[model samples]
Target chain A: MSTKELCIHLTELHAKSLLNDNDTFLFDCDGVLWNFPHIFTGAVELLNYLTEQGKRLFFVTNNSTTTQDDYAKRFNDIGYKAKPEQIICTAWLTAQHLKSINFKGKCYVLGMQSMKDELEREGFQICGGIGPDPVPSDSNAVTVDTLELEKDVDCVISAFDLHISYIKILKAATYLNRPNVLFIATNDDASHPQNDEIVKPGNYNAK
Target chain B: MSTKELCIHLTELHAKSLLNDNDTFLFDCDGVLWNFPHIFTGAVELLNYLTEQGKRLFFVTNNSTTTQDDYAKRFNDIGYKAKPEQIICTAWLTAQHLKSINFKGKCYVLGMQSMKDELEREGFQICGGIGPDPVPSDSNAVTVDTLELEKDVDCVISAFDLHISYIKILKAATYLNRPNVLFIATNDDASHPQNDEIVKPGNYNAK
Candidate 1:
């Protein structure tokens, strides 16, 4: 599908309801806020309107590769005043959600570094990944700490990765596919605008 | 199996393989290096040996959070001179591996900020997820991102999330089940050692 179709679908979201001051409005960053190659035509206007209305604008995206400051700067560079407190990207949301719900203190994340760090903040202990060594390859499954299944977990979050491979898939799917484990994502855009080209990597494998 | 059994199996890896001077020895930081509560029996020795032998000791781990520098400091605090350069964290590895494979530089990762930042360093364009939101009351189909099904994606990687509901699984599984899509994991440990307690929130969910 073209970006137009995706954008149209995304725009339809706004028609469903006008966000209230008390109710939070969640907006994905790329396709929704800033369309591929071009910022959303009405983005600044909408932000201005929201600010005037005193409504909470939450930029809850799934792209974990950036921090709120990054998004804020990008938005600012693109002519919008993106606030750190308002731009609740996936990493931010993931961290807040986990802490609010009290996710387990120790975690075995399978995501970008930010997501991992976010989890660690909620008192979760981080266990790193296995390296590319053991010759025969899949002779053995990588060993991880048995913390969640052994007890209870808050969730499992995944971020965007441009260079994901079969091994990453097998490892991530292995865990994300579990019934007891919680699964979370940053945003759900099929493609991201990169260097004037629409790049593909996130939606298919991790979504 | 039990923790001891798992440990025995990991130790058995030494016998199952040959030691190489060039083959880097990568180890996870949180659980494998130490018991989380006490100092690892030989962390200092191991680090010193790794540096002295000039063995490329790459710590390829799945913990998708903390940054390489943060990890280095943690390792250093524990008496190991771990540098961000010496670490092959999942976040960094994802980007490094993606560049090595000539990926599209677009990503759909299910991880944290560090994971995303690390991948972006390799010039990756991060994508968010898109789909219908969860039914609020349901736990099975929590959609994290709002991406479409037909978007072209190069790969998918997962890290740690403790809050994924059942609904989220349905969405990700639908995408990941496709053919030719790459999957990768930073680490596969089921959990991590938080404090005196053996906490949960590891990779068992996605296993």
Candidate 2:
């Protein structure tokens, strides 16, 4: 079938997925369809198309770990019809990985709270925030998130949080820097669209 | 006049002092007026009485280093009337001094952005924000708000910036431990008022 036919078929499947609550369509935002400034040609049309077909749409990203408030604001700023609930990050996913592995203890989270809150509900405690700052060595710290081959274990995941302050990025780097620590991340995309800027501010840059 | 009458008049005068804006009636909320949950009975009354007189009011506190916006919110939360402009803090006041004294060059800010912005505008360059969990090096930043004070410049000034966190405090105290450098604090009041909470988050406890 032609690309147009394929898109239409995907929309039909999206509608079926939403009806059955089984849709898990994760699309890379940048370069897959359009370039930076994210005011891409068919952005809204795609979302509307999916929603019309009742597809559960989620915009998974690697470079977000701030807050839902920031995410909604940024997505709106960039003309993306993204609800805070729809955007995902590696930080959020990592929180889950820790929980699935029965990781317990306070974490100094350097990322967003939504994912951290999810992890916390599963009995993980965040000692502090993890991001671009140096992670504090609180006795309660469990681990920082990264996706390295030789790192130790807990679980790894990702989500988007925007508080990319130097302290956040730097501290997460420090935890991953440890030889004994396990590291995991999400997306690991080369580039992501920020409000008006392109950011590679996540683990890949540290790598 | 008799002591009773004299006492009554002094009470009335102290009540009026709130609005006097003459000598700058200063009170430390933590220890002077009240403890953590209560206020000195006379303080609010005096403040109200002063407001009736349209006096210029200044609240100086040492315990907190939150931004003026945060302070204003705290004031509103507790039923105290405050404009962000009317509040004075050691962190704020210290930033003022640093700027006024021509603190220049890339210096690590041992305080929050509210404090950093004030100093940065005063012509000093901010090398980085002192992390919430600061390192020994992060703790010991070469910041000189005043150059002429003995030592090889780069003096550290204390403000009631609550965001200084534990590590920053350790660094500040350690930096001060050295005899060659100068350490200055903007105020010595034991605490500041925020709604009902009397915080000792400032350097009063650190001292």
Candidate 3:
């Protein structure tokens, strides 16, 4: 049989063997556990059943918009028991990855509040993410001077952001020009599901 | 050439290239950094010189008797500017390893206070370590019942313990008999440097 046919079907014995081989299970959040406003039917029951069988369950997600504390609260509010440490989101993963790579310099972030929060919680120095918007000036007669990048900025991280601007991207690009500077992105999803339609996400701005 | 002759005749140019190729350095704590009761001369100066050259440094040690916080305090007290996060001791490594392996059940530890503290900080449920010793019974009429291990214990970690007891070893052995239980040891050094003499350490008790 072709590989396409095998992908669409699974024998009962094969499924049973796959399930019995591992003591740990990892689940994704959006589109798998819950989509926006509604939780998947019987998802809670499946999680409880896994727990009853002494399986170690971890929730891994590409969603970097929500903090681990917020995710934990959402899980408990929806009648599912979860701790903050059990939710491994992309924001936390990015911080851990940077630390494991022995990053010691400040970061230039083109991201949202949760990403900044996660990095700061790990004691990383971050810059150019959130602040008051730069005031717009229409004076063209003013002399233009060469812009200098922040020498202390040595890392660039891009994630989903509702308030992304050209200024943030410029700073991130300046940092990227330096040798040995680390660059990372949380996810590369072009579009995400909404209530009734798919909408373009922050990846467009990240580019 | 003999091994002793080669060890005493290293070329200075070779040593320079070896140190210049790496941007990060990890130093061991006990014998490499300092011996007992005396800090190595000019060690602090060398660390500062490395910092001046923008080299990232970390202290890695197998000593499980001190928590990260205690180690940081010791460094600062001895006039070295070091943070707790820059030090990776066996206590912290053990906790991280358990988390990485997705351990979900309680742990039974035959170890020291630092090991228990580090595990508890990471929200691990630990049992059977660091409590008041059971009262000694001198009468021959009393009979000890069959040992009952903690049913929820699914991991056993053995480290250096000043007050090693047979009861803790029995509990560890009982947990190890169960299938799928993780067994970990911080270090297996037969002896360690004391104030003046090399004395046998806690490995025998751990076994």
Candidate 4:
């Protein structure tokens, strides 16, 4: 048959067959489940129906700005049952990846507070991501020669940061310039949808 | 002749021949003429000799941290006769490039005050390079939704900035995301020598 002929449309018969064939469901939160402040049509009903059918469900997203706990809270707020373990977000995955590699040191982050919280929950020391580290008022005051870098920063994590700065880049580059220092980016998304007209820059743009 | 056999040492005979063959010479400042705070042994003598012989010379460097005037001042301070016109640095080159293209708009700078001075001298309005634009102390106070961006930015220039921040990156990225906006980088140097042990991360690392 041709490719177009092989394509199947979603009907009641097809839906019943699909449910019977699949024991689990995976949903992407940003666009599939909801777009924040508004849930998609039948998204909640579908999740409830899936739960009633005893089908396992997992929420997957590349949002590193929020932690797994944050995702769980968001899902519950929207009337969806989501456990911390059931939400697979970039922030949680980043921490998990570090743990899997047996990394034991401080992480200099260029991301949000939630990313730091996720790493901290994984028993890692974090720096650089919480608040602004603006350039000195007198630009000449802080030269690379005078800037003090942390001695124990073993990894540099790049994620979605609203407050990325030159000082942070200098520190991250200086640390990564050393041998065996790890450079981790939570995601490489170029931009994220904010609304119909504006999109926020992602981790790739920070580079 | 093989490459090794063709290579001749810089004896007086070869030096005389080289001066006779070439009427103009170009020198790199960092490692060649001086290492900063210390001039090489015969560097000054050679420049004086070249000037006596009426050889035209140029000082070229990828350093965007200082203006051409700064370079001329450095050379004169080290007992070398250098004019601003004889010095070619990245900061000067960047401004020249913008002018050459007939660019007539504001520049968002991720560089030093000297770089800003160069652009201003070339008749361009500038922003974002002077001082500390740290993230707010309360990180939660600012989100992508609430972040304010400048509307007049037409070009994003990335140079050697010590005070690069998340806010700057956001602005640059947002500006560049527009269709007609330009992105310019002063240099692509991976690293610059500090002394013997430590190397400062250069413009390339900022990316």
The candidate scoring highest on lDDT is 4
**Fraction of native Cα contacts kept in each candidate?**
0.00, 0.00, 0.00, 0.44
Span of ten consecutive residues with least summed lDDT in model 3 chain A? A135-144
Candidate 3, superposed: residue stretches over 4 Å from native: A1-207, B1-15, B131-142, B146-148, B205-207
lDDT of 3 by residue, A79-186 (tens): 788889989998899999988988888988766678888999999998676432221222211111333346677888887754443344445655676688788888
Over 4 Å off, model 4 = A1-14, A35-41, A127-130, A141-145, A196-199, A204-207, B1-9, B127-130, B140-146, B196-199, B204-207
Q: What are the per-residue Cα lDDT tens digits for candidate 4 across B105-179? A: 988887888888999999988956454565676674236566567778788888887776656666777777787
Let me know the DockQ for model 3: 0.01
Candidate numbers sorted by lDDT from highest down: 4, 3, 1, 2
- Ten residues in sequence with the least summed lDDT for candidate 3 chain B: B134-143
Q: What tier of docking accuracy does candidate 2 attain?
A: incorrect
Q: lDDT scores for all predictions?
A: 0.57, 0.49, 0.69, 0.79
Give the range where candidate 4 chain B is weakest over 10 consecutive residues by summed lDDT. Answer: B197-206
Backbone clash pairs for candidate 3 read: none
TM-score of chain B of 4: 0.89
Task: Put down candidate 2 lDDT per residue, A90-130, tens digits, no spaces.
Answer: 54556556757776544545445555655665577554553
DockQ of 1: 0.02
Ranking by TM-score: 4, 3, 1, 2
TM-score: which candidate is best? 4
Expressed as tens digits, the lDDT of each residue in A88-202 for candidate 1 is: 7676677787778776644444455565555555566654321211112222222345222323333455556432333444444445545576766666655544432223435
Rank list by DockQ:
4, 1, 2, 3
| Tens digit of per-residue lDDT, candidate 2, span B31-93 | 554553466677667666666666666666664345566566766666678787767755566
